[model samples]
Target: MAKKKNKKASPNTIGTNKQARRLYEILETFEAGISLLGTEVKSLRGGHVSFKDGYVSFHDGSAFLVGVHIAPYEQTGQYDQHDPERRRRLLLHKHEIDVLQSKVDQRGLTVVPMKMYFSRGKVKVQIGLGRGKNVHSKKQDLKDRDIQRDTQRQLASYK
Candidate 1:
């Protein structure tokens, strides 16, 4: 008889924007509900979401998530299919929206989607208020990461 491999499953993480941390200095984060279509929610549950090049924008005092791609559900018929890159509304309190609007008005500060995941059976997005990192800062971050990695490796070998 063959032995079964029982692997531990990770907590549900639909997708994350790895590039966001590298490109931006995130100052604060917020968890906001996403207004998703039926098909879109199904696709996200199936782990078909992309945050690459995705950003947040506001209009008429409402926040919108733009550029994030949620692949349509494979089983859904054409008539019920949702657009892959539609602008989805984000549910935030009025005060939160006002704060975000003010921060975005500052020079070089903007909002971006950091992660998408399911929470308590509902799809949610983690958005961040960030400033774009300059070249020197990026280089410094890379150097610090390298140093940390080296120290961890040395400690592990000694142990």
Candidate 2:
């Protein structure tokens, strides 16, 4: 008789953050593990989280994720529900944390959330160190995008 084949369940892989469709520039992206409670983890698995208010800060040789909201589990009650807007710690190497800290201190770079996803059953947040876009720069980006879209549409029509 042949042995039965056992199949392992697939690990969850999905983005849980607002994607910037027209990101003018992406400087650097860092993979950092996120600290989450049981309920928070469950909420992320549902995949409706937002990064509109998410930002990262370094303190005491570590980076912390601030303003990242993970809503409470819908089926849970208030007794054991953790704060949805709690500050979560980001797990990164000591050297990497130091580098990010130095950049923020020396330069005027800002830490912004690029995306959030699950890897090997652990939730991870990708942070981007970026310089803010000025008004004219943003307008130029919009115009460039519009031109690209128009070009693509014309090419499609000709084909």
Candidate 3:
């Protein structure tokens, strides 16, 4: 008998924080694993998560995902329900944590959760270090995007 080979599948995105991209100019991003309870995982699989006001925070040499809401698993018993707004720990190396902390403390950059997805069988969060964009910058970004879209449309029509 021949041994079987296992193939890896592409990651499945659970949710994204669109507001973060629009409101902040991302400078750097890091992928970190998230700690979740059984019910939380189930709820996430069911696409019951909100990224509103979600961001990363460092404390005591550890990173945490805060202000994100993961809805409770609907079929779970009341006793087994998990808190929807708990601050979950983010799994990152000591060096990575230190780097993030330093950047935050020194540069005054904010760490926000950009995306959440399942890589292999585990959940991962893509955290971004960013500075908040001013209103003028945000408007300029919108104008640039509109111009890019018009150019693309004209080129597509020519094709």
Candidate 4:
């Protein structure tokens, strides 16, 4: 008989956004394994995930990722469908939780999801603790971004 072929796997870098990076400054980043169902994993692998409206929350000393939607895999069985928008648990260390708790206790900070990537064949979410940006600050940020992009474009032309 021919030898069995083990299924191959690859880690994909699902690029994040400016908000994730901007907040990553004061934001302590902690990687945690996310709980996922079979279809959820398949959908995430198929790039059917979104973190735009997602936010992290702490409950009973455990942090969770909420509002992240991973579409159901179409090839799966029909009866036991997993909820796409259910609250998913984030696996973090005790010390990390303690530190996050203190920072979250402060009025201005909130936890945000940074990136989600596969690690050792399991999906992981990178969460961050950060303070919100005011309207003026957001405007200043846009200005800075435009300036940076212009500088990069100018440099590219000279090359």
Best by lDDT: 3
**Model 3 worst lDDT window (10 residues):** 4-13
Q: How many pairs collide in each candidate, listed in order?
A: 0, 0, 0, 0
Candidate 4: 10-residue stretch with minimal lDDT: 6-15
Kindly list the per-residue Cα lDDT of model 3 for residues 80-157, writing each as its tens digit.
Answer: 999999999999999999999999999999999988889888999999999999999999999999999999999999
Enumerate residue pairs that collide in model 1.
none
Model 2: how far is 22 from its true place, Å?
Answer: 5.6
Candidates 1 and 3 compared: the better one by lDDT is 3
Each prediction's Cα lDDT score?
A: 0.90, 0.78, 0.92, 0.77
- Alpha-carbon deviation at 74 in model 3, angstroms: 0.3
TM-scores for all candidates?
A: 0.91, 0.85, 0.91, 0.81
Query: Alpha-carbon error at 95 in model 4, in Å?
Result: 1.1
The list of candidate 3 runs beyond 4 A from truth reads 1-11
Off by over 4 Å in 4: 1-11, 15-18, 21-26, 153-159
Candidate 3 clashes: the total is: 0
Alpha-carbon RMSD to native, per candidate: 2.5, 6.8, 6.3, 6.3
